[model samples]
Target: MMTTIAAAVAAVALASCAGPGSAADDAGERTLTVYAAASLTGTFEQIAADFEAAHEGVSVELSFAGSSDLVAQIQQGAPADVLASADTANMDKLVDDGLLAGRPADFASNTLTIAVPPGNPAGIASLADLAGDDVQLVVCAPEVPCGAATERVEQAAGLTFAPVSEEQSVTDVLNKVTTGEADAGLVYVTDVRGAGDRVEGIEFPESGSAVNVYPIAALGGSEEPELAQEFIDAVLGADGQRVLTDAGFAAP
Candidate 1:
């Protein structure tokens, strides 16, 4: 009877030592790492939450950056289970390298817009206004998806802009405008919508010339390929699309 009581006491001691989120408790948990464009930050975070709620003992780790940067990271062997690029061009680089489990699915589309400080402080009313010498314009670098879209818009509008700063991601451009570091910045329509009242978005007709199509796929080297594919499916599903459209992204 003493031996039995001692064993029970030992078991209780061990149980008490096992705290919440301890290695033992998390040993069964699976983590899915996703590398996506910066513009998809808010929407993807929301989707990640929903996905975790649906799958027991699953957590999503998201890395957001410029499409070009994300592709480069994956090419350098980053441990990402999924890749969601803001443009087909960046996604194609991975496809050419055979780094994707399958063909990427186009999920959503977005267009460029001018984001100015609240109340249009610089009075940037159109794409042409961004080119004025007195206006401080910020834009994404040419290698990034948003920058490529900006170039297309410039071509369609037959204008040129000398940006005071060139950022690597659309989020950086938006940040500059919102922080008053720039008079205006070229960012995605969805980014402007996400910014809410922090910045005022200016819609121009030329934005239609360069609608960026977003694509998502599971990586070929993922250890959790099934889970990665499931996450992609979730993003393409109706509820995910609803979250995206609500954030100002268009259907692909």
Candidate 2:
């Protein structure tokens, strides 16, 4: 009976000595979730990896999809600490919806390019070639930021394109062209650059008429508001800018 009482007293003493900063309290407590547009996949992944390296005991969870689709998910109560959009319009929508914890900031800009299979299978030398009836084309749906930019470019160039298929994400459009499902597609220059030799990019002057501005913000009601802001700061800081520019994105 004395032995059991002594053991209980020792356990109470140990518990009383444990501080609020105990190791057990911190283990696996640092997790941040970021929802980003599909166009930002490559760079954002690199950023997340680097952030994890810099901050010990922290992990970053990323969700990549179309800007519009991501916003819709947030609206439907998906769990995320931060949001990065492919365009300002989508971020504005979220801001208007009162879904953001802070004001969104522009970080980068991207322009559309014509992506054709390697060796220019369709002989697509310019944007005009994508309009030929015989040339099968894939594009993002008009609701997507890339597709919205495509519409602006179309209006400026006075060209009407009847795509064989419209995907929900720019990556999907790129995949369709690369897989030979479509002869060509309208995608970001970064996607073409990222694809390397898989696809050839055709530059057009009209592309300058429509450019996408990417924005990011902390989401409201985040479980880790401080960590979310730190991640956002990392993205807007020098290291993040370097990674983005190296990935074919232009500085904002």
Candidate 3:
């Protein structure tokens, strides 16, 4: 009788361990990966937090880098459910390559600004000041969105600069200014906002001619298309627009 009782308890324990609702099955929750431009980092991170709060059982994994680098990753078939570029040109490249699920949408826009150290020690005030031999400048690589916008603004102002460094992202350009590595750097207006008291933003009239439009879309071959689409919608919705606007991004 004792042996039979022990066998019965062991069998029940084993059954519970092998039940239909086991831990292994519960681990099937979905995780969505999003690759986005570096400039969108702060705002997108807040958006992701809000999204996770509203959607249970879903996780958003965000990767932030230069728009061009993100585009290259997507083209190389990185496992991303969504891609957001700081400019439409890179997005068009992905779309042309047939890597996006549908047409990309312009979610936000921004213009270039000259970011300077907290006090503007160089007595810099305008675009032409950047060309002074004594003033060191940092700029994004021409291949990146912010760099391209800077180039356009420079051309519009008929000015030239010899930057001390060509950074890979707008954030890097801002960092160079904030750290005093360079007297001035060309960066997105949103980045200037993000920097807050760490740096000061100087407005240049030529920046208006070089507005940058940020585009986002669901990637092709995504495992969670529906969720990806939902994320895209959220980014374009009222709440998302407010976040972008508050971060100094302009309407498309």
TM-score of each: 0.92, 0.92, 0.93
- Model number with the top lDDT: 1
| Candidate of highest TM-score | 3
Clashing pairs in 2: none
The global Cα lDDT (0 to 1) of model 3 is: 0.91
For each candidate, the alpha-carbon lDDT, in order, equals 0.95, 0.92, 0.91
Q: What TM-score would candidate 3 get against the native?
A: 0.93
Candidate 1, overall lDDT? 0.95
Q: What is the lDDT of residue 99 in candidate 1?
A: 96
Cα RMSD for candidate 3?
Answer: 2.4
Worst 10 residues of 2 by lDDT: 20-29
Task: Give lDDT: candidate 2, residue 228.
Answer: 95
Steric collisions counted per model: 0, 0, 0
Which sections of candidate 2 miss by over 4 Å?
1-28
